[model samples]
Target: MIRLFITRHGQTEWNLEKRFQGSKDSLLTELGEKQAGMLRDRLASQNFDLIYSSHLQRAYRTAEIIKDNREIKIIKDKALSEMKLGDWEGLKYDDVIEKYSKEYDLFWNKPHLFETTSGEGYSELKKRVIGSLKRIIRENDEKNILIVTHTIVIKQIMAYFEKRPLEKLWDLPYIHPTSLSLIEIDDEKTNVKLHGDISHLENNVKEIC
Candidate 1:
């Protein structure tokens, strides 16, 4: 069996402002740093055999914060990076809708049919995320693993495990920053025991954009 603890990366200034970050590098806000520290404190007792994170700064930085004094080797993987927003990178939500109405509309309501300009589609992201999961499963053998990644990446990974089509990917609950999701994997089955859990957070904790 394999135990997986998956979390979305901490918040960034763009995230706070509800802007699309895509693959662009963004640093964590002060509140995001606090979130990471809170997570570290909450999960200090949990032992993980392996730690993996997206190559991006935001995700890896969040992992680094949680790692604290632990000696686990951190593995950076491109497969866990956020979706590439292409021309839409760094744009605000409203501007994206006004400027690229067709693309924005399709992305929100019918993601499977939408493709970022010169970028990957949801099916491709699903394939990449599942491929990464396969590799992690084989390597983990029978151990606990932690993956820190972006919202879309986590969503795609969850969709793959739920055996759902890419079109219905967004149907699942939204995964917020610093939220944890637990997965149990056996040779014959993979189960999502929990999703989008923020019980570790304070009552007034700010939501990720």
Candidate 2:
């Protein structure tokens, strides 16, 4: 059996402010750092054969915290980066709606109509993210693996394995920051669940934006 443990990076300033944090990098907040540590504490005992993370600072930092003193060498993959939001990056939630109505409307509520002006297209993001995931699966050869990535990437990966169409992506539960997901793939069957589980955070779980 193949065990795929996927998780999102910790919270950022933009996340707390409800800003669109596409490819733009942001520093993790104090709470964010704690979240990563909590997640690490939850999974530290597991024996992962390989670890991968996005090249973005937030994700890389979370991976570092998770790795801690472990000998694991995390492979930073750009393909796992979050969706680039073009001019929408760094814009506040209300600002995005008021400034870029056409794009923002579709981006939040209508994935089918969402389109980035100077960023990546939906198909492009889906293709690259899944391609990278497939490559990892092929090489790992059924060993347990850990993937540290962004929100959109994790959503897409889960959506793909769950056979959920893009239009229904939001139908699934919102994946909180530092949330963990487990995807199991094998010859006989493939299973995925716990898309946004943060039970590891104890009772101090902050609301994820």
Candidate 3:
């Protein structure tokens, strides 16, 4: 059996500002670092054979915190990065809503039909993320793997495992920063043990954009 522990990076400055990070970069907030520490403490007893993270500083830093001086190697892969938001990369939520109203609506309401002006669409993002996951699974069987990525990336991955349609991408139960999800795969069977779990954060859990 293979155990997959997946999570999103801690909250970032842009997250607090309600700005779109997408492929752009941002530093983690103080609370974000605290969240990572909490997650590190939460999984201190667990062992990971391999750790994969997006090249983004926020995600990579979170992975490092979770590693906590462990000898585990963290492989930074662009395939694990967040969906490219193109023109909306650094724009605030309200600004994006006002500037790109139609595209924003499609993104939240109908992801399958949404198209990016200069970035990747939902299908493109899913294809790359799922492809990376499949490659990882194939390369490392019967191993505990850790993947630290972004909100949209994590959500798309979970949705794929759940066999959910793209149209229902933003259903409910938001993927909070540092939220951990576990999946077990044995032979051809896949089981999701946790999905968007924030029990580690306890009362410190705060919603981010």
Choose the strongest candidate by lDDT: 3
lDDT of 1 by residue, 18-122 (tens): 788888978999888888888899899999888999999999999999999899989999988888888788888989899999998899788878976566788
Per-residue lDDT of candidate 2, residues 143-196 (tens digit): 988899998898899888888888876666778888999988897588885677
**TM-score of predicted structure 3:** 0.98
> Model 3 Cα RMSD, Å?
0.9
Clashes of each: 0, 0, 0
lDDT agreement with native, every candidate: 0.86, 0.87, 0.93
lDDT of 3 at 33: 91
Worst 10 residues of 1 by lDDT: 200-209
Query: Please, what is the TM-score per model?
Result: 0.96, 0.95, 0.98
In model 2, the Cα lDDT at residue 22 comes to 88
lDDT of 2: 0.87
Question: How well does candidate 2 match the true structure in TM-score terms?
Answer: 0.95
For residue 46, model 3's alpha carbon misses the true position, in angstroms, by: 0.3
List model 3 lDDT by residue over 1-209, tens digit each. 99999999998999999999999999999889989999999999999999999999999999999999989999999999999999999999999999999999999999888987698899899899999999999998989999999999998999989999999999877899999899999999999999989898968556655
